[model samples]
Target: MIPTDWIYGLIGGVMIGAAAAMFLLINGRIMGASGLLGGIIDGTGKANMKERLAFIAGLIGVPAIVYFTIGAPATNVSNNMLVLLVAGLAVGVGTRMANGCTSGHGVCGISRFSVRGIAATLIYLLAGGVTMLVLRHGLGVI
Candidate 1:
């Protein structure tokens, strides 16, 4: 039988897609969080610094607002501070190497029918799936 988590996943996917679509449609720019945040920090976004700052601030603060309004998310992450730091650095490196985050390439880029975006999305998914399989099944980490 299909897992019930799949329904929540589908809803999340739909919401992400819709949000990315709206962001691009309104801004006429890619809805890439990393790029947006990076540009904001570097003062190189297409818009003025104030606008970029506002966007970045909104991105950071809106989730907290929503979580407070609803409820905080539960996570099963390890409590190791060193591991978390290394994982975060690795993710930042991967995002740079991939040229975009999953939301940017998988949702916004794919919506624009970019071949590179599609390939990157497939590679990202395949790599993640393989890594998880190896970690859980082969290494028995989970």
Candidate 2:
């Protein structure tokens, strides 16, 4: 029998893609989570505070609901406080520098054929691949 995990992932991907497409079509704005959250927190989203709030709510709420209904698999998240802090900081810096997160550039932007998004995606993928290669393989961390 096929593993349920792959099925769940496929379904999740479809849902995310459809949601992103619908959000863009209905709202006429790119659905970038970081931008949405950052704007609301920094007051830049004041113009569409309601919309941002709803989006953010769904982002957090749906997962919580799913967890209650169907618990998630165990994660391999790090327990090291310093590593976690550094990783979080690095992601923040990287996202700010890139102007969007992977979902924004990869899923939404790529689907729309956005040049900036394409370039940003390529750069980040390369960086991430190299980092993973070094950390997981070269250093034999894994």
Which candidate gets the maximum lDDT versus the true structure? 2
Misplaced by over 4 Å in model 2 are 1-7, 140-142
Superposition error at 83 for model 2 (Å) = 1.6
lDDT by residue (1-142, candidate 1, tens digit) is 8787998899988887777777768866677777776666556665656656676788779988988899766878988787688778877778767778787887877877999889989988898899789977999754
Clashing pairs in 2: none
Instruction: Evaluate model 2: give its TM-score.
Output: 0.87
In model 1, where is the ten-residue run with the lowest total lDDT? 40-49
Per-residue alpha-carbon lDDT of candidate 2 for residues 1-142, written as tens digits (9 for 90 to 100): 9899899999989998988889988998788888887788678789999999999999999888988999966778988787788888898777866778978988988887999899999998999899899988999653
- Model 2 error, position 134 (Å): 1.8
